[model samples]
Target: MSKPTPLSGFPEWLPAQRMIEQNVVERIRATFELYGYAPLETRAVEPLDQLLRKGETSKEVYVLRRLQEDPGARTDDSLGLHFDLTVPFARFVLENSGKLQFPFRRYQIQKVWRGERPQEGRYREFLQADIDVVDRDNLPFHYDTEMPLVIGDAFASLPIPKATILVNNRKVCEGFYRGLGLEDPDQVLRTVDKLDKIGPEKVAALLVETAGATDAQAAACLKLAAISTGDASFVDQVRALGVTNDLLDEGLEELVRVVDAGTEYAPGLIRAELKIARGLDYYTGTVYETQLQGYERFGSICSGGRYENLATSGNERFPGVGISIGVSRMLGLLFGHNALTISRSVPTGVVVALPAEELRPACDRIAQALRRRGISTEVAPAAAKFGKQIRFAERRGIPFVWFPGADGEPDTIKDIRSGDQVEADAATWAPPAEDLIPVVSKA
Candidate 1:
């Protein structure tokens, strides 16, 4: 058979890179927990109908089936892998409303599948870190501003390149489309979402050709899409486009509040953008798209928006707002460009070399002592040349190499990176604090 084929965009990390991913996940969890958000996990698959409820045509869902045991078996749970966690979380909240408290705050980080064509930082499968607060009834407007700050803090805490979160409001987007006489606001949204894929010129063409917009109306929509500024005054520029509707006005006001609120707490965190029409149909209020500085070609590594009842049995309302970070996609860009890196390969704090066959037990005891002290330790595999042993530690980035001092003596700990040797008591030795905690890197 041919050699195993490596699928594109499904990048896998070695031990070092995996640790960086874990570090990122841990940091996100820590921040979320610090703010009193409880952790949650939702099933990976949902009925296809549930997945398709919002009419996301471009969302390439991975449908699943059980291996056939009988021909006549049927299932109503025709399932597909969820494209994102927000949708499933909405379903979870609605289904378990009685058990969960109101204004539920949750954090979920898990793998989601989407079958879109592989791009620089996008793939068929990836990890998403989402944090959201859903109220039993109408969601408080403060969350629109608070959620972005929470997400911005998560990004700011990382060592990756600085991120810019572009904020928008769907009511404003729809209002503009309606003012332009576009028959279908949702269709206009899908067209505008493609602005990055296709230029504004083509977006205009698609709206005119497919969505029934006249040339003048299409131009106005394109003009509205081009409106992006650094401050609330951007609203003045957007209104300059001559669109009028209270829904649009409300969206604009909400986004302005977000910018103002973000500036008060975390200055320069969120910026209002008229062009950022989140294509998702469910998003009713403020929407966010996070882009990495110097990696704009990589596209938005995080995105989400407000929704009106993620889980609706037709009557009950569960409005919520949230943002989700594409952890895997961000890591891909981070590692590819050396934006995030680790300093070591293995977690070995110290590796003791056997001076002779007779001295093996002493080395084992020392290593075990370190382990008991909550330090990482490894004993040399077998009796080998001292040079070879030092090479072993060096190869794995094991900083400390312990050698039998002299004729069955204590030992010495050598800093491999600095090449500094220090005589110490192997029984109760302590490495430098950072040395005890090994630095991680990208593969």
Candidate 2:
């Protein structure tokens, strides 16, 4: 037999690490439900054309093929693994429009695959927690604000650090570029989206060479991207830029509403950043990007935007706003830094010991009694010495070890951490609330 080599991009966690991941996911799921978002899941694969609808992401898509299929005999749409949840979700909405409720809100947590190079917080395969709200025709502007508030609540509920949602309006950037007499605003946006990747100077060069922007226009765009505020003051800052257009005015008003809502509800959680050009072409309105307070250099951990027509049937349009949290990316970062921990490596709260092979049934009954009371219990594997049995429990971080009664006397449970042993009845005894499940902590 040969030792197996590990794959670089695919991530797998140990038991304790996975415990933290599961806890984080459950917290996110509960938060999504709290906001009235129903759980939904889409198929793992979609038509290649459907997955490639968004041009920028097409190169990242992984095409699918069956190993045993006869290539020449097949005649069907080419299929590919979904890169993100949004595209399939849009297709789902359009297909089930008649059966679904209007203003549909759904939360999806699933694994997504991408063909990009993996880094510290990036993986070829990962999990995403997404929430989207779509309306039949025109989606309300309030949803743009609600999206961030929901994100704020979810992040606040987790053990992670405080997160800031950096928001921008596509209209703001388009109007500002128009005010500067730049003919192709989207090109400038695509270029500015690379500002963090390539330096500002390269982005400025790209704006001029590719987007046909004059030096003054490129400089103005750079300046606009530099303005970011925590509250409504960003409205005044954009006004100070002296770029006035009808679309710009509308965008500023909407942004003011979003900032105000954040201020009123989740203060200091939202930031108005003009330069955040969410690279997707479908985002026609508000766009969002989130960063952990101390990990801004790592880039956005969650991001999304409002699409005017994510799904359509003839003239009917399904407008939607959404945000997706990169669960795997976040956990990768946290786990790499040893920033998160679980109190136990296993779920068992108590390990019932057997004094002899004859006492096995007694231990089994006691284990059943504890389990009936909603406590996780496991029986010792063998009738080993008391010291060896305690070691087994200690090795797995099991807090309590139950020693059955001798000669039909009362049983005793030992708290390994404190070495406190006391008489207890299996039906009535229980571990403390905090010890009932693995506790997650942040370093």
TM-score of each: 0.95, 0.98
Q: Could you tell me how far off, in angstroms, the CA of residue 157 lies in candidate 2 after the best superposition?
A: 1.0
The worst-scoring run of ten residues by lDDT in candidate 1 lies at: 434-443
- List RMSD in Å for every model shown: 2.0, 1.3
Question: Candidate 1 clashing pairs?
Answer: 341-441, 342-440, 342-441, 342-442
Query: How well does candidate 2 score on lDDT at residue 259?
Result: 81
lDDT of 2: 0.91
Give candidate 2's root-mean-square deviation (CA, Å): 1.3
lDDT of 2 by residue, 213-237 (tens): 8888889899999988888888888
* TM-score, cand. 1: 0.95
lDDT of each structure? 0.83, 0.91
